[model samples]
Target: MVREVITYPNPILRKKSKDVEVFDQKLHTLLDDMNDTMKQHGGVGLAAIQIGIDLNVLIINIPLDKEGSEDDGKQLDENLIEAINPVITHKDGELVFTEGCLSIPGFHAEVTRAENIIVEYFDRQGQKQTMEANDFLAIAWQHEMEHLSGHVFIENLSFLKRKKFEKEWKRYLKENSKK
Candidate 1:
């Protein structure tokens, strides 16, 4: 099932997600739904909170072609990463990447994140997994993990940039309301 993604200004997006203590059928279903939703929205990654669920879960599946690979631009299910209760165990260096969120549609901003990271998380089956990711993958982890902590990438912007974004966002909301 492709769940509706909760947008910005929704209180649920600000609510800190609770850790998944029970690895059961419900968790599995949520993960499945998230994958469907992410693909439907054409997002490289998604957090559980993005779908109005307050569980510490997120998935990342960058298209093979996006990494300059020879394969066609398709996101493979086998490459989908389900991170439950993820924690950034290590971070090194820094890089800036343009990021867009499903919640904040039509807005892309350059956000500085760790260039490399070691994340410790649990897979869909409750098995503990550790991933060492760099470049775009590392940025994805930092972005989605922030959602689990009730933070948004816009918060990382400079004061001036954030204020500008706020003005533009308010205008966008007004236009959207008319629709």
Candidate 2:
């Protein structure tokens, strides 16, 4: 079963995720939960902080699993790329695309992101790896990586544009309040 992703304006998103010093069953559990949560929410990626876990762990399986690229270049369990202490080391080109966060729910905003990026982080096994991603994959990386830094997709919007989504956001809040 998948877990519901926490939404924006939740204090968890603002708190920087802590480094995962232990690569054990707990970390594996988080990886599983993150993947389940992301899949359930129809999100390509998910961050630990988004799920209210302050750990430097994130799962991404976007353009990758969608295109069968998960079969190539260093296999990870079921295409779930768990990045601990992830950081964007380099970026190039730019692409603006609609983006939404599980935390924010019900709303997506047009946001500009690097079309290509070089990211550095540790794999779930505690091995350091740097990988390059482009197009949709890069966007997914940026989105999830931002969560590690205590930022949400809403922060990508302009003040006025963000205000425009208030009604829809409010509706989500109202509906969720009963849960």
Candidate 3:
């Protein structure tokens, strides 16, 4: 089931998620729903918090093809990653990437994150797993992990950019509400 993604300014997005202690059927169902929700939203990644569930769970699927490339629409279910109680064991270097969120649509900002990372997490079956990710994958991990900690990408923006986003977002919300 594709769940409704809770949007920005919703207090749930600000609440830190709790660690998942049980790897049960319920957890598997949530992961499946998250995958559905992410695909439906055209998002490459999603956190349980994005769906108003305060759990340390997130899923990411790096698009198989680059944007604007000839084979742009290609994707594989095998690429889907489900991380439960993820912890970044190591991080190295820095890279800045424009980040967006399903919970904060119509907005993006360049945020600096580790260019490479080693994450320790549990798979859907509760087995421990380790992943070494770089570039876009690393960025996605950092971004979604922050959501689990009650932080948003915009919070990483500079003061001027954040202020501008606030003003513009208010206007955008007003315009949309009038429609």
Candidate 4:
């Protein structure tokens, strides 16, 4: 099931998500729905908070081609990664890239993030797992992590840029309201 994605300015998007304690069938369903929702929205990642759920869950599916050629000269397959209670245990270097969020609709901003990260998380089966990611995968992980922490990409923008984005977002909302 593709869930409705909560957009920017929604209070739920600003509220921190609660940690998932029981990894039951419901959690499995949420992860499945989140994957469907992410694909439906053409997003490489999605957080539970984006779908009005206050759980620390996120899914990522970064295409191999987007991982950058400079990333250890290795290619990854298109794998669905479901992370519950993900934590960034380590970060290395930094890179700035233009990023967009499903909740933010048609806005994009240059956001700086760790170029590489070691994340510890639980898979859908509730097994403990850890992986080292770099480049786009790293960015995607960090992006969804921010969502779980009640923040959007615009928060990383400069004050003037954020203001500009807020104005544009308001205009967009107003224009859409007429129809």
Candidate 5:
């Protein structure tokens, strides 16, 4: 089942997630739930913090958004997916993109990130794995990894940019409050 994502101003998002030591049933379930939640909400990625869990866990899948692909029965880009914990060992090639978060609704900011990276993580089955990603994959990994470190994408914004978003952020919070 998809879980409710905790929004910003929730203290859980501020605490760094604890590392996973035991690869067990609960870890497996959490990964499943995260994937379910992310797809349900049209999110590209999800972190344990978004689900109010404090663990070094996050999942990312960045499929290219091609028009009408979902409606035309076209096969999904398999390269666009896989679950990971994402420890960056090497990074190069920088780019900036405007990023938003599942945990911080209606807010986005430009964040500079490595365009390429080598990462180590576990697969869905808890098998230790490592991979190198460039371009979109690297950006997606960096974005999701920030959650495990108790950082939100908006934090990459300057104070002025954050201020610019404050009005819309408040409006989103207010609308969501009624739900």
Candidate 6:
């Protein structure tokens, strides 16, 4: 099921998500629904809070060809990754890139993130795992990690840029409301 993505300014998006304790069928279902929702919105990632679920869960699926491949030169059989209660243990270097969120439709901003990072989290199978990510994958991790902490990419923008975005977002909402 593709759940409705809660947009920006929604209270849920500002609230920190809770950690997933019992990795049961319900968690599986949520992950499945999130995956569907992200794909439906043509997003590279989706967080639980984006769908009004205050859980520390997020899915990231970047096509290897699009992101310039993962850390390894070899292509991954499965690029769709589910991170539950993720923690970034290490970060190195930095790069600025334009990022967009499914929740904040029609908005994109330049955000500086680590060029490489080591993340620890539980996979969909309930197994603890840790891996290093670089390049676009690292940026994706940083983006989703912020969502778990109740922070959005817009927060990284300058005050002027954010104000402009607010104006644009309001206009977009009003225009869409008429339809």
The superposed Cα distance between candidate 3 and the true structure at residue 60, in angstroms, equals: 0.2
lDDT of 1: 0.92
Once fitted onto the true fold, the runs of candidate 2 whose alpha carbons sit more than 4 angstroms away are 63-78, 175-179
lDDT, candidate 5, 1-179, per-residue tens:
79999988788888888877777888888887888898788787788878998887887766544652333323244533444465889999999887878887666777899999988987666787888888766887888888889888877788888787777788888887799
Candidate 6 residues lying further than 4 Å off, grouped into runs, are 65-77
Candidate 1 residue 94 Cα shift, in angstroms, is 0.7
The ten-residue window of minimal lDDT in model 4 covers 67-76
C-alpha lDDT score of every prediction, in listed order: 0.92, 0.81, 0.92, 0.90, 0.78, 0.89
How far residue 85's Cα lies from its native spot in candidate 1, in Å, is 0.8
In order of appearance, the predictions have TM-scores of 0.95, 0.86, 0.95, 0.91, 0.85, 0.92
Estimate the Cα RMSD of every predicted model relative to the unseen true structure: 1.7, 3.7, 2.3, 3.6, 3.4, 3.3
Summarize candidate 1's per-residue lDDT along 1-179 as a digit string, tens digits. 99999988888989999999999999999999999999999898999999999999999997775455735548977778999999999999999999999999989999999999999999988999999999998998999999999988999999999999989999999999999
**What TM-score would candidate 3 get against the native?**
0.95
Better of 1 and 2 by TM-score: 1
Backbone clashes under 3 angstroms, per model:
0, 2, 0, 0, 0, 0
Clashing pairs in 4: none
lDDT of candidate 6 at residue 108, scale 0 to 100:
87
Q: What lDDT does model 6 reach? A: 0.89
lDDT of 6 by residue, 121-163 (tens): 9997889999899888899889988999999899999899999
Candidate 4, position 155, lDDT: 93
Q: Write the per-residue lDDT of candidate 4 for residues 99-175, one digit (tens) a residue.
A: 99999898889999999999999987889999999888899999999999999889999999999999999999999
Q: Return the clash pairs for model 2, or none.
A: 7-103, 8-103
